[model samples]
Target: MPALASDVTVITITRRRPEILLRRCVPATGRQTRPVDHLIVVDDCPGTAERLSAAEGVVWHHASRTPDDMSGPGRSSRLRNWAARQVSTPWIAYLDDDNEWQPRHIETLIEAATAAGADAVHSERNVFHADGRPWLEPIWPWSADDAEGRSLYREMVRLGVAEPGRNVIHDRVDPLDIADGIRMVDTNEWLLRRDVLLELPFTETLTDVHEQGLLGEDDLLLADLVNAGVRISSSRTASVDYYLGGYSNNRLRHQDPDFAWR
Candidate 1:
C-alpha cells in the first residue's frame, strides 16, 4: 500500500532567496504526487517569509539568530534540525530553496521506503547548469554508477579480502551494524523517518575548515546516521533537478582547485 500524503512533511530551509523559493521550490512542492501534509519553510532572513503568499496548512518560521550567531558551516544544519522538530508527520523530505523536485519525488521515496523497510531513502538527481542545460556526467557518490570504490569495498568484504569489522560497506549491508561509511551521501536527496532523524540529529559542528571556505555539516550528519545503524535505500531514478548557480558554496568551489567545476 502506498503511504498517504499526510504521512510526510516537506521542509525547506532558506536564507534571503525569496525569488528562488517562490519561482522554483514552492511550485514544484505543490505538484508532488503524494501532496505533503504540510510545507514548512524555515526562513533565516527576516521579512522574507511575509512576501510569500499564504496557503492552507503552509507553516512559515523565521529563525531567531542573534548578532553574535556563528554564520558559517552548521547554520543550515541547525535550521533543518529545528524544522524537523516542528514536523508532526512520520517522514520528512528536504528541498533546498534553489532546487526543484519532480512531481513524483516524495511519492517515489515513500513507496520505496515502505517496501524496503528502510529508515531512510534517497534518489539520484539530475544536475543542470544555471541556464538549464543538463550536465550529462553523474554527480559522484550521489549517483550509484560512480560508487565504484564502495562496490569494490563490498566485494572485498564478501571475499574476505577485507575484514567485515574493518569495512564501512559492511555496516550498510546489515541493519544491526553501526560502522561509518567511507563516502558521504547528498543531504538534499534523502527522505528520512522523523523519529530516526530525531534520534540522530544533525550535529551542529563543522567537519571541514579551510582558508578558502568551511564545509561538511551535512556530511557529518549523514555519517552519523550511517554509523547509527540506519539502513538507507537509494534509487537511481533521478527525481530532483539540482541547479548549479552562483550560490555561496558553488562560488567557493569555482575558485577552489580541489572542487573546480569540470
Candidate 2:
C-alpha cells in the first residue's frame, strides 16, 4: 500500500554532540508547525544517548558503532539508514544534530511535496556562522580561500538559486538539471517518502568519505532518486539554518591529505 503523505517522522543522528542536539535540533522538532509524528535520534555513544534520553518527544536509540562510522561525511547516510528502519510514518524528513529548521520547515516542505506530487522535496538553507547569523564576513566562507565552502558557493552563485547574505550555498536540486552540478541538496533540507527511502537506501555512501576521501553521499542519493524517476521538487524557501563550525564540520574528513568535506 502506498503510504499517506500526512504522517511524518524526523530522523536525526548524533554520535556525541548532546549539547547542540538537545538545545537546537530537538526543540526545532517540537516547534514544527506540522508537529512531527515521530522523532528518532540514533546515537552510537552510550553516554551521549543517556544525555539525550530525557529530551521531550524524542525517541533515542543506540546504534552499533563501527570504525568507519566514527568520523566522516558519509557516516550520516549510514546513520540515517539505521534510523529509517525504525520509522513508521509515511513521510520522512531529515535534520542534522548541528542544524535547525524554522517552525514552518515541516509544514512548508510537506505542502510543496503534496502539491507537486513529488516523492521527495527539498528546501533552501541559509549557511550561517557559529554565532547564528548568515555569512557577513569579509573573509567569506564561500570565497576561494575555503576549498569546500568555495566549491559549494561557486555553483550556487552561478545558478542564482541561493541568497544568504553575500554568499549562497544550499539551494534545490533539479533532477532535470542535476547533470549541471547543484550543491543545494544538503541532508537536512529534504523531505522524502519512507517507501522511496527503503526502496533505495544510501547504503554505499560510507565509501565516498571513508575510503575515497571525497564527500558525496547526498549527491549519490539524489542521483539514485533521479535515476529511479522519483518525482522530486523544491520549495525554494529557506527553511533551514545550516550552522558552520560545528563538531562534525571539523572532523568530516578526519583522515587523508587528499580530501575533506568541511
Candidate 3:
C-alpha cells in the first residue's frame, strides 16, 4: 500500500443525521488541539458522502454494506469494521456522530499511548444533556438491589474497579476488568493501533451475533484486546463529551438514576 499519511485517523460512523454530522461531529474533530491528520466519516447512506461535503480534513466513505449487515445483528460493529479497513493511518480513533471530543482528546490519547508504549489507549467521558447541560452525576454507582446492575457491580468490584458502596470508575480502566464493568469503555473514548484492530477486528458483541437485547461492542472489543495481551493505556480524564439521547442512552431512557451514568 501507499505510505501512510498520518499517525491517527479519526473515524465517525454516521447514518442520515446530516445535521449532527455536519454541525457537531465534524466541527469538533476539526478543532482538535493536535490538528487531526485524517478524519474518515463512514456513512451508511449511499449518497451521504457527496451530500455532506464536510470540512477539508474529513474523508467521507460510504459503506456499501451487504443485506445481512443491514438487516442482521451488530450493524454498528459491522459498519465500523468496514470503515476501519479503509483507514490509511497508523492509529484509528472513533468519534460517534452524536458525540464531541474535547480539544485535547486526540492529543492526550497520543501522549498516553506513546508514554506507555501501548497498542491502545482510552480516555474518560462525562455525561451531558442533548442540549449541552452536564448531568448532575458524571458517574454513578450500580445499585445493589437491581439484579442486572447488581451483577455488573459485583463484577466491577471483583475486578477492583469499584468498592462496596463506592462508585469508583473515575479515571482508571483495567482492560481485563472493563468488559464486566457496565458502560465503562465507550467506542468514542478509544484510540487504538490500526493494525492491531484490523488483525483482531470487531469480532465480538452483536456485530454478527444476536443476543437478547445485549448491545456492547465496546466491551467485547476490550475483552478481546485484554485476552490478546494488548498493552492498553488510559488517559484517566474526561476528554469526550458524551451527550445524552444517543443509542444507549435513548434505549435506557426509562430507567432510574442510572440514566446518564450507565
Candidate 4:
C-alpha cells in the first residue's frame, strides 16, 4: 500500500519555464501513485504565477527576485527554502521543473524511508539528452563509478550508512564520512523529513569564486546533511528521469566546447 497522501508534500522549483512546467513536470507529478498532500510550485520568475492554472490543486508562490536578477549565488536554494517553509507535512520531496518522476517515485521513497526509519531516502536517476537520447554514460568529475566515487561509497558504508539492499537502518550517519571527493546526489531524487531538512537547510551563499562554473546547490546541501549526521537510505531503482537540456545544471554543451548541439 502507498503512503497516505496527507503525510507528504511535493515542491517544484521553476524559473520562467512555464512550457516545461506545464507539459512535462505537471503530468508526471499528477500521475504519482501515492498523491501528495500539497503540490507547491515556487516560481522565481515574477508575474509567472498568474499564468499558471489552478485547477490541478497546485499551490503556487512567486519569488521576489527572478534567477537572472539575483546578483550572487544560491538563487535556487533560496527559492526552495522559501517554498519549504510553506509545507505542513512531515515528509517533503522535490522535483525539478525540467525533470520528471515515475508514478511510483514517491511511493518507493516513502516506503523505503518508513521501513528503514530513516530521515531521508534517495533513488537512482536516469539521465537523458535534450533530443531524447540516453545519457547514461557518467560524466567525469561527477560519475559515481570512478575511483573517487568508490572511496566515497566505501566511506559511507564504513561510517554506518545502511545498505539499501539489506533493508537495514542506521541510527545516524557519520559526519566524517563526507569527504571532499564525495559524489553528490541530486536533490530531485531524494525524500527528506521536514524537521531534519529545516535544521540543515541548503547553503544560500556561494563560497566558490568562479562565476560561470558555479557548483550545484544540491552538492552543497548533501555535504551539509552528511556533516549534520542525518541518516540516509538509498535505492538502486531509477525512479526519476533527469533531462539534460540547454538550461540544465551541468550545461552539457557548455561544459564540452566541442560538443554539437542538435
Best by lDDT: 2
RMSD each, Å: 8.6, 4.6, 6.2, 7.7
Q: Rank the candidates by TM-score, best first.
A: 2, 3, 4, 1
Candidate 4 off by > 4 Å: 1-5, 42-47, 66-73, 136-182, 209-214, 246-262
Per-residue accuracy of model 1 over 1-262 as CA lDDT, tens digit each: 1223578887787767687777888888889898785454544566576775454445677677765454444666677788788767889888887788899988888888888898988876666667677644323222223466467555545543344332111112324343542343456678899999899887775543421333355556677776786878865457878777532335344453323211
Residue-by-residue lDDT tens digits, candidate 2, 55-93: 554576677755434444545666687677766788888
lDDT to native, each model: 0.64, 0.70, 0.67, 0.64
Positional deviation of 106 in candidate 2, in angstroms? 0.7
Per residue, candidate 3 scores C-alpha lDDT tens digits across 1-262 of: 2233667878777776677777778888878888665455454575567666644545666666554354222566766787778767788998888788889999999999999999889997766668877654313322322565657656656765545543234445553455554335788889999899898887533522323334456767877887788888888767888777654535454453322121
Task: Say which prediction, candidate 2 or candidate 3, comes out ahead on lDDT.
Answer: 2
Model 4, residue 106: what's the lDDT? 92
* TM-score against native, each model: 0.72, 0.81, 0.75, 0.73
The 10 consecutive residues of candidate 1 with the worst lDDT sum are 165-174
- After the best TM-score superposition of candidate 1, give how far the Cα of residue 62 lies from its true spot, in angstroms: 1.4
